[model samples]
Target: MQAKIKKVELRNLAFEDYKQLKNSMVESYPEMADSYWRANDIERLLGIFPEGQLVILVDGKVVGSALSLIVAEKLVDKKHNYSQIIGDYSFSTHNPQGEILYGIDVFIHPNYRGLRLGRRLYDARKELCEQLNLKAIVFAGRIPSYGQYSNKLTPTKYIEKVKSKQLHDPVLSFQLSNDFHVLRIMKNYLAGDEDSKEFAVLLEWNNIYFDESPRLINTEKNVIRLGLIQWQMRSLGNLEALFEQSEFFIDVVSGYTCDFAVFPELFIAPLMADYNHLTEAEAIRELAKHSEPIRKRFQELAISYNINIISGSMPYLENGNLYNVGFLCKRDGTSEMYTKIHVTPNEVQHWGMKGGSEIKTFDTDCGKIGIMICYDVEFPEVSRIMADEGMNILFVPFLTDTQNAYIRVKHCAQARAIENECYVAIAGCVGNLPKVNNMDIQYAQTAVFTPSDFAFPSNGIKAEATPNTEMTLIVDVDLRLLKELHEHGSVRILKDRRTDLYQIKKIEN
Candidate 1:
């Protein structure tokens, strides 16, 4: 589909573009040809809220568009037919001061159906909802394929089939793919939706960043699902190739609705193929040059996939000093970095790396998290300090070259989970990068750990991937469990600490 070669954009809908859009609407839905948008209707939408009307252009022509309006929750909070909500085609329901961004209609030209042009329009609507601090993206979407199965299945049954992939409804399937969930099966929503059999699905995509303080639903998330990659050391041709591989994994996990995705330390070091000619020390410094680009790309992915990413650890050279750093790229398009506080003797002697002293915790949609790089996990003091700061989860991105080293990381991680009474997730690279010097061999087993006691796994391991193989381990950890363990569990580790005798001092430089 030459999509890579095509130039696409989401621009404001203009009065002059109405004719082109009408042709697209008719072609995409000939059954509703009489319901084609009028020039006056387009003008009214623009006059009401110009930015709410958006168009997707491919190569300078409108191929798709999304029409929306800000509406009060009280106005359309209950089920109402299409005519009542859209004010009989005059768009009278649009309220400039409303809190919900209601999607009135979205369509892509028939010729552009499979190109994901509709998603662009939907994504743009979500961005708008976020930008305006709207509560959610609400719409009634047609289940156009329902008519085919109407003789045998009810509207509810048809929706269940579409959701489970047993059947495909052009409109409902596409909407579901965009992260919209069906709230209810609406009946007679659209009077003449013959293809849908006069039924529709009430779908919604909530704005995660909706700020009442911009604060999340509560003080803490109940459960958070994590995906950790047991990465294989591959010889990459370039940084883009490495990012493409990362994208594939992120997309897969996002499909499973993971809240967080963790990559192994030095995952991008595979791109070091271009600099393998240099000395190990020089080659790593050359690799550190990709810090900004790596962070930028990962940020884009976090938003695109709607998953929080602990971008493993990367070579970060700062002020003529080499360091290991990882980024916490939030789904809301923001990022924070955590540096490896304790560098191994091997790193100091061979790569001339320095240790970071600043210890911190990051607040995410899930809860407060702390990042500890490979060797950093071995230092119990760092984890304790973060735990003292109310960290609920700690992520470790390591690059070990031996099974013994991997074991040390695994065991220490479990100890941290128990001692700090928080979840610990560790991921590392496996296989060998034969051509890349100083990083030719790796040994790893990805795993997530929980505090040992009642209400948790007996072995202290929630889930683990097979050793020395490439795969992903997904597990769910309840933050509330950690809280219970802290206050009322068999061991009350966080509450039992003898603060009067000693404390883990975290000094900032």
Candidate 2:
């Protein structure tokens, strides 16, 4: 008869499950004369690391358990025997600062055997290792069937045969099938396990996701150069003309040592010059028609220049509703869009654009970043939420028509930088668009901002272009410095946020 595990639930081991776990262990390993784990031993392991302890439940009852402890890599390198590593199953050497996970014990009830409960427990261990970013999972697995062949074959010879598929040992074979590799065989690893002649196999499962590179140690060495373009507005020409104009900036930025290039909000409004004779609403609809081609060109430009490009905010039509959207085109040929979450009165009243409801931060090789178009940056909550999610930089692309309008965006962006302890980069359209209807006037001074702390520039401005000039401003920001500020800055705004008093929760649509 096949074992049917009905209603199997996997969860963290709680203190209350100790009794059922003990019963399962006793029933699973009946061949042993003494208890595999004492009550105090279980309690000590749980007390030290509750996150590493997980139990499998069926019908609200514990059916299996897997316990693990973190240990230093050097400890595993020096110790060969299981008893020496685990300190006689007491887990006295568990280290919270360890970089490796040491699997102490895994057991399933006899009645629950063949139900793949052991596999589930192992999967949970693998996930825990990933979450902790551990180096690897190392454990001494018993060779239960080795005792029967002890008289005929040596431990090393037995292992070679099992590895070669000539023989099968229950524990080692199961581990091998689960992507574990045998490091070597150990003698007298387990004194009480007579089934394996007290021998064990040293096995390891590496966490491939764990990055051990030493690239991020020096914050100064990790710098991302950005190019901010204060694009000059001109009359709309053919698509070829607009493409050529964009390619010129891409070409110039590619000549420099920069990782990303940014354009301003409504940078493509110049393309709507032909329809400028029409009403404001008609011209916006016409501008939305070029959204797809603009996105494709930006993607191609990103790939051609081998640089990440924030294509800036454009009038985008989706599902018959227009939105102010920014396209993030990565050099790897992937792209994502960020819609303006907050619509201005002028935009809503004149252009029929509605505010977006979703907020997203894009993950890059440098770090996590978020995009907030003009009015969105004015709200403290938007930038605050992004900073809370580990975002190191916030990109704002604006289209202000007056000096006062520009100052509003500038002051709000600077305030966000100071409050969130994050870098803010703003790129905007400069010069006038006489032929274009609602977008005929423009004013901007593209600038990269930093937090107002000792670690950053005194004025909080990393680099800025001359006001209303059609030029690109290049600046290299250090990611390591941003991380350091979060921990040791003059003020810990992100860390010191009073969440107990008031919490900002996202209202999902």
Candidate 3:
């Protein structure tokens, strides 16, 4: 029969449970005679750092425990013995100001071995790391099965075999499965440990959530390079032509090592071969038919070129309702969709499209970013809400048939950057599509806008393509400067907002 763990409770280690903890540790590691910890050591550890020690109880009985201490990165700089690094189990070198959490020991009772209680203990340690914002978790893992192969293979060879799945080590395999990577093999880590042959593997679990990139306001490392394409309309030859044009720009941007590439709204209009014969509304419905293929091609291009592509906006028909949607394709072949939240009267009247209410900010390798389509940037509240959610960049893809319409998007984009203290990149469609009904004429100028501050350009324009031209404009915007402007600029608009007077609450359905 299997033992069922009923009512498992986890809390900080208390003084009364010292003897039970020692007994559990001794029973768990019966092969090692010196495995039991002294009462005075436990008392001293608890007194120094009470939060680092945790105890597990099953039915009011001590069944498991985890001990940890904080250490600076310099302590584990090079390959060294565990006893030397840990100061002979005294942990006298523990630093409260350290950025790493060093795991000393974790064990569970024999009766609770199959209950997955060890995984729970690890989960608790990870939670504590997040709460403390630690850089990573490090420990020396034992390879219990290496003792049998010690005569035939070296410690490094044994580790290589275990990593390649050619050999199975109970402890090392468990740690590897839990997202821990072995840094190196340490010799004589334990003096008399027969199971490991006195050797151990140094393992580390880096916190993926930690941001280690430089935060200098004017440094090149702080910039997010953008490639904006001002697409020119010509002929709707076929779907192949549409794909060829998109691949051309993506290749160009990737060659220049741009972080993200942006394209204009309805750039896929060339796929609608029968646009001249179909009505305005019918053409939009027809364009929606190629949404899946368009999305797939963008994802393939993003992965092949190793670049991020904003697929602009497309006419999408879902459940008998039409919407203008944009797809952000990451280099990893993953994607996120943003629907037009504020549909213009022209879109509703001409294309039979409805407005979307969902707004979101995407977290990327560069930074937090948001996507708004064309006219959506005209609304200050939309960008403000995104900025409040920690978005440092906004991408606006637009399609305007007249100069006045193009000016609306450009001016509003600049205003959004200034008002929100964020960077905005706008890409638009240009030239003429004489055969297409609704897309016959276009006027655009692709540009990257920045906040009007001392750290940015005086005109607030980082880079801009010539008006009515078909070209790709590439620019770099520093996100660190945006952070500085919000905190310590000439005019702190975002921080000086009069929130006590009015508030904008999002209504959830």
Candidate 4:
């Protein structure tokens, strides 16, 4: 029966119900029309069949109840006349059906209606069913009582759907509200009770989510030509002697007409150094003024040959420390300097040089470019971070001695390019310096490399210049062709790498 709309409390009976329970239930529902419990009956039930008392309260009053009982009778009756036969089942070691909880009666006081109080009562009974871990909760009720209260139906027709192992009515409604479809129905009933019309239904949750990593197209086929030249004096002691050599190398690069040119670790010489062979501060100042003339020489070379030149690095002694820097000079003489961010242990330990911390990518007449110095390129992330920032070309200038260690160091530069899908141009020391103890040692086999192979095809050299050899390697790169190969190429290695699973931070960031 329907009642007034009001808030109600839903809870299990935990206390004695005497006077108020008698007035609200016993006296009020004498005809078994409202509720069956007097207040004390609640306590007694809790004391005896404690598991059966599942109830709800409305403003501290019991408005609903779900109880259970056991009947000692034969499994089959007249109702089983047309019933289907099934296998034997029992409880304990002898029963395959195990124990069962029978939901006996569920009632709501007529005073408390319209609140869907009956459903809450049903849910409480279901909870008891689960707590007892019964194979199933079985109940018998009139189809009229149940069907008339369909929306509020206990042991609903959906119970048939559930019994037949079909979708749950309420759960299916919940599913449809959230976009889902029912698969099938399953039926399970008391073998002898087939004619009795007592049964259940089963349900399943739907599959709806996924996990995938994003994919990039092409992801390879990039080419870059990098040249590293150290301008001015070789090392510190012979600052005055290498001016001629520097001019000769500059002319060689100008004549070579390469796509890109890079000068060594400290390209501008004493131009960036605050001191000139222990000269006075005023003399050092005069030396700093010559940087413009030298830069102009590099600029003219770039313009005349139509090449992109990274005027290697210079110590821009701004503020207090010397900044390891490089300049990307276009053919138009417009130049942007990329300061080296990662300084070596020696720089911090001995030189008073500080590491730069900025990451950047810039657009150029040739393409998008990023810059790093000798020590900076050792870390893959330096290049990875630049690639992530959308750089297509990486210019790196290094200073090293002649040794196998050089090849190992050079491999990293190639890896940075191949893995990040960009062109890596590394300009390193190709000459000897007389001052610093090992400065004159020719360190590496300098070259440019790509993902599939070295920068140059197998038919040609990857433009390796000699140690102490002043020359330029000119390689014409078809930027569009490289991009095309990256997109629709046969073997796309760069795009296949799963970066999320890799530990980039673990690699000495």
Candidate 2 to truth, TM? 0.61
Model 2 C-alpha lDDT per residue in residues 1-509, reported as the tens digit of each score: 13554588999998888888888788888998765677788788888999999999988888888888999999988746777777776787899889889998888887877888889988889889978889999999999999899999999999889989999987898898777888877778877899998889889998855656535463223588888888998865588788898889988887895778888888888877788678788889898988889899999999999888998888888888989998999989999999998999999888899888898789876678989999999999988888888788899999999999999999999999899888899999988977777876889999989998887999999988999989999898987677668755888888788889998767777
Question: Cα deviation in Å at residue 486, candidate 4?
Answer: 2.6
lDDT of 4 by residue, 1-509 (tens): 43453556766556653444445565434533533444454554555566566667766666666665322223322132111211121111112233444444455666665466767766566555455444344443322222323454445455555445554433234323322233233233432223223332222221111102213752332344444453323443333444455546656665654556666775444332334344333332344455455566667666766777777775556665566666676877677768788887665554556777677777765567888888888888777767766677777777766566576567887777667766666666555445332133545444555554433365223455565454454544545444544543454445555767863431333
The candidate with the higher lDDT, 2 or 4, is 2
In Å, residue 88's CA in model 2 sits off its true spot by 14
Candidate 1 positional error at 194, Å = 82
Show model 2 residue runs off by greater than 4 Å.
1-221
> What is the number of residue pairs that collide in model 1?
1
TM-score each candidate.
0.58, 0.61, 0.59, 0.47
Q: Rate the local accuracy (lDDT) of all candidates.
A: 0.88, 0.86, 0.86, 0.53
Off by over 4 Å in 4: 1-250, 267-297, 300-305, 436-442, 453-461, 489-494, 497-509
Better-scoring candidate (TM-score), 3 or 4: 3
Per-residue accuracy of model 1 over 357-454 as CA lDDT, tens digit each: 79899999898999999998998998999999999999999999999999999999999999999999999999998888888799999999989997
In candidate 3, what residue range of length 10 has the lowest lDDT sum? 212-221
Clashes of each: 1, 0, 0, 29
Cα RMSD to the true fold for all candidates: 18.9, 18.6, 19.6, 25.1
